[model samples]
Target: MLVQMFDLLATRRDFFVGLLLEHVQISLVSIAIAIVVGGIAGILISEFQRAAKPTLAVVNFLYTIPSISMLGFLIPFSGVGDATAVIALTIYALLPMVRATHTGITNVDPSILEAARGMGGTRMQTLLRVRLPLALPVIMSGIRNMVVMTIALAGIASFIGAGGLGVAIYRGITTNNAAMTMAGSLLIAVLALVVDFVLGFVEKRMGMRSKAAKRTNRRLAVGALVACGVAAACAVVPGMVAGAPATINVATKPMTEQYIMGNMLKDLIEQDTNLKVKVTQGVGSGTSNIEPAMESGDFDLYPEYTGTGWAMVLKKGGTYSEDEFGQLKAGYRKKGLGWVGMYGFGNTYGIAVRSDVAKRYGIKTYSDLAKVTDRLKLGAEADFFERADGYDALCKAYGMRFGSTMQLDIGLKYDALEQGSVDALIIFTTDGKLSHANATVLKDDKGFFPSYECGNVVRTKVLEQHPELRAVLKKLDGTITESDMARMNYQVEEKGEDPEDVAREYLRAKGLLK
Candidate 1:
């Protein structure tokens, strides 16, 4: 337990540094955006005496909405990524800054305004020199609030595939791994505390300078303004250029067959069409990656399971026939996404036992395994821990309980099972390692799991724009099988071959590529 805790902590330290940087980046950008946009809105709203109360009320109401729900609402439009996260945080930060700006500007002393007017200062000059100076502290305070809230909110961005400390926490919680959960939670807390302290120090320094009779140093202020302008220009350059015809954006989950398939498709599409492809991996669990990126128009294509499309992407709940490709296609169409066709394969979930263990226990089927389940240990992936058809549900259906069972990450399950630490594991039917290890897949005599055929999901608009893309993808239909997918997965994941290389080779062998 100690060693496991130490390992988790060490891994968390690495993730913490990355999370801290991401938090800083998102919070700073969001706060900056809030200041400029909210400042303008505040100024405009302040112009009308009747509008001020209503405007402030609206902003306050928006601020009261829970951040997570706000993020979910934004997903269909903004999709999953850093952009959505920043936009959501920016909106959340707007209320405090707007309120601060209005209060600061309105509270300017009438006597001071009269004195400035009598001194022959123009409206612009008086507003800039007197009103701004007096209000700077309050505006800064608003900015401080925005900064703190945004940092906290940014941690949750990982839910939508925006990597941060939240990824660690989400992974830990889903896996039921106490060591990982503690490490992630502790690291995030420390990051938040540190950032808050740093910002507080800056706020204090600014306050001290404001109290002194001296104005803020003009050169320092100008330098900061210039730096911000440069950063803004840098961010805008990417969307300007027209992406190439063969360019494809493949989005997929991290360390899974879908991820590998997405990368492979990128290569196959490029090789067959002579186009460029960019693969974006590490998307989080479920159809979370599919709809968001598709709706936002950020991704060109991605691999998804038919059942995932049926239940999650389509939001339809219940058992369905295994040969329901049409249902999956209909579901995607209804959701404004396009289905390009299957990869001629399905990756089913099943219980796997080491060859030696299966031989020892004479366990060839799930029914046989039930007899010895009380003496065996089971390991499951994070998703399998929580999914309706997962270990808990499976156990209930089987009327048996393992002697000891724990959730393990999909990536680590093979190692754990191979080392004899776990007697059985929940795994994808087509996982390459299962073939490599001579493991036995217990037949689901009861057919507990749903079918998960692999296919490409595209934005409806993208399909309209590039009609040929769907045809290109459709060529792969009925070509790859479960065993073939397993070999390909093993080639990339275990044999250290590039996914693109594996894909190209497969395509070439199939005479799909020149």
Candidate 2:
């Protein structure tokens, strides 16, 4: 397993290295901020004995919040990526740093302090020359613990579109790639261990008694700050190019289909025009994340599902309507977002089951599945369970109460069905795995789902600036059939082809690109 993990990771060495750099970037920023802020808070509280317990209680409360939940809470305000990741990591690292600083200082021998004061030491002098030196070991121990925790929690940052080693892990989980998942997990563990060992060694070597030791400590502190500054710069510099002329930013949701679409757009634009393109794919929350970024002009365009725009973005309710496309266009236009014509596929949501199970249950529609709810175990993705238009709403509409429902990663849903762990799985109509998994998709006899026609959702401002972009995008209209999408996805998911290569090949085969 270990050898296989390394072999899998070696296939994408550059990507894994970038993940490592990003993981270090956020971890360093969080730890640096924690040490300064937590150190100050610790010093302040130590002098005021009455406030120590209450302050520590507050810091501990932050420690109790789950890492992913904390990242989610900051998404709306920070809008994902490094800002949210760094802030959450900093808060998580605080409890240990603060407690350690306070414990180290307060534990100093009273007799030693009295002797220092009697020897003409002032309050500040006693703290700097005597107390801090004695407390260095304890304080460094807390810092070491915080660094390790931050490194581990940084993996969760990828859930919020923050790039890190965690993104690789989540992608592996979603794609049902055990070797990839193991590789990511092993890298994170290795990173944590390396950080712990280095910090531990430094802690042992530090002794403020000697002038040379004090100079070495100062040099180390300066080096750490420089590294933190470099990380911060690397994170912020990308946002600077958001509105650069003749450059476009494309984004995609976290799914196989979306990834293909994003890559397709990137390839088409770069080849057809003089404009440079950058793609940010596998973003969390689908439209929720992409739409906001588009509105803020952070991203120029992305492939979006019409039904998602109608229901989630437009906030309209009730049954699907004939005028839904018109309504969707108008709704997005109001928000300064333009919707291009559909890209020749309508990938709606449906309940799927293994072919043998479907035959045994006689389930051809959602209503038919409801009849066997008491015997069926349902499986769905994490977002499907949480979204308003997801599992709960689907159940209410179909009157379904399954024997059990397992929350799963989208990538693992097919595997779960093949293994018979789930009787039915929620799936997209165009998923390539449908054929591979030998799953039969049930029809929505009651018209519970709206049309999910895929299209390019772009910022009006971008279209206005590069008017030819609209025409370039329109060239993609009705180009890819449902089968084409499914086959393309299969190539990437099952055959291990890079999404960009799959998309590029599709364009070249269609004579759509040079």
Candidate 3:
């Protein structure tokens, strides 16, 4: 496993190393914010002893909220991206930071404080020269804990379009590439360990009671900050300034197929025009997150589906229809959005049953499956259960009454079905696993599912600004059929091919690229 991980590092040095820098930047930013805010609050609470318990209680309550829940709560206010991730991480760091500072400052020897007072030391002088120094070790311990936890948690920053090592981990898991997954996990683990070790050394150095040791401590702090700043700069987004080149920010839903498409979009736009493209892949919850970011101009465009636009974004009621595409277009226009490059494919929802189960039950359609649903266990990704067209809708439409329903990760549902842990699972028609799975796709006989033809959902203002993008974006229109998309997905997910390479090869085969 270690050798495999190293091999992956060798092959994909840029990807892992880039994410490492992003992780560092986010962790450091969160740490810096926590120390400033939390440390100050800690000092105040320590001085006003009456407020100490109450402030700590409030922060402790905040610390108990799950990170995912906190992020979700913050999304509406902060929008998405690095801002939200940093805020959540800083909030989580507060309890430890404040408690440690307060504990350290208040625990200073009374006699020493009295001696400082007797020597005519001012409050500021006592704190700076006497109390803080004594409290440094305890404070450093808290900082060390906060830094390590912040780094580990930063992996989740990718969920809200805040890119970090977590993106690599998510991609590897989705694509069923164990080596890639291990490589990402190992990098994050190594990073946390390295940062912890450095901070630990600094903590010990700060504890030494001598002029040389104090100078060394200052040097270590500056050195650590400089090194981290350099690492972070390496992964920061291409700088945008008053005179910078025109740039397009593209977003993608969290899926292997979208990653391939995102890279393709970047390559095409950059190749055909002067616009620089930045693709942030795997924005969690698809339309729910990305749409808002789009509205706020955090993203200029992304691949979107007709059904998602119809139901999720426009909040249109009733089953979706091809006729409603016009309405969807008009609705998007109201929101200053436009659709282009409708890729020729339908990734509609489907229910797949283990071949053995299908054969035993003679299930070929929703109606047929409904007859025996009560005897079978159903499974689907958590998002599937929440979407309007998902589990409950299907169950009501066909009167399905499963014996049990399991909420599994999108990547694990197929595995669960294959292993006989689940008799049926939901899937997108374009899922790569479907190409070689031992499952039968049951017909949506009731016409319950909606079409999900993928397309570029661009900000209309961008179109007006960069006319060249229109042609480049349209190059993908009607170019890829369902089979083409599924095969591309298969190449990436099953074969573990790089998504950009797969997308590039497909585009070349179609003579859409030089």
Clashes (N, CA, C under 3 Å) per candidate: 0, 1, 0
Question: What does candidate 2 score in Cα RMSD to the true structure?
Answer: 2.8
Q: What is the overall TM-score of model 3 with all chains considered together?
A: 0.95
lDDT of 2 by residue, 67-92 (tens): 87887788778776678899999999
Better of 2 and 3 by lDDT: 3
Clashes of 3: 0
In model 1, which runs have C-alpha deviations exceeding 4 angstroms?
A: 1-27, 31-79, 87-159, 163-217, 241-249, 268-278, 292-300, 311-322, 354-361, 374-377, 385-397, 401-405, 416-422, 436-440, 495-514
Per-candidate local distance difference test: 0.73, 0.84, 0.88
Q: Give residue 392's error in model 2 in angstroms.
A: 3.9
lDDT for model 3, on a 0 to 1 scale? 0.88
User: Tens-digit lDDT track for model 3 on 1-514?
Assistant: 6787788899899988788877878888899999999999998998899999999999999999999899999999999899999999999999999999999999999999999999999998999999888998899999999998999999888889998898888777877777887887888888999989988876677668799988887887798789767755654544744666798999998888899999999989988988899888788777889999999989998998898788788977678877788899999999999999888887888899999999998989989999999999999877778877778888998898999999876767788988899999888899999969999998888799987888999999999999889999899889888888899999988887989899899888888779
Model 3: clashing residue pairs?
none
Name the candidate, 1 or 2, with the larger TM-score value.
2
Which parts of model 2 are misplaced by more than 4 Å? Answer: 1-4, 208-247, 386-388
Arrange candidates by TM-score, descending: 3, 2, 1
Top candidate on lDDT is 3
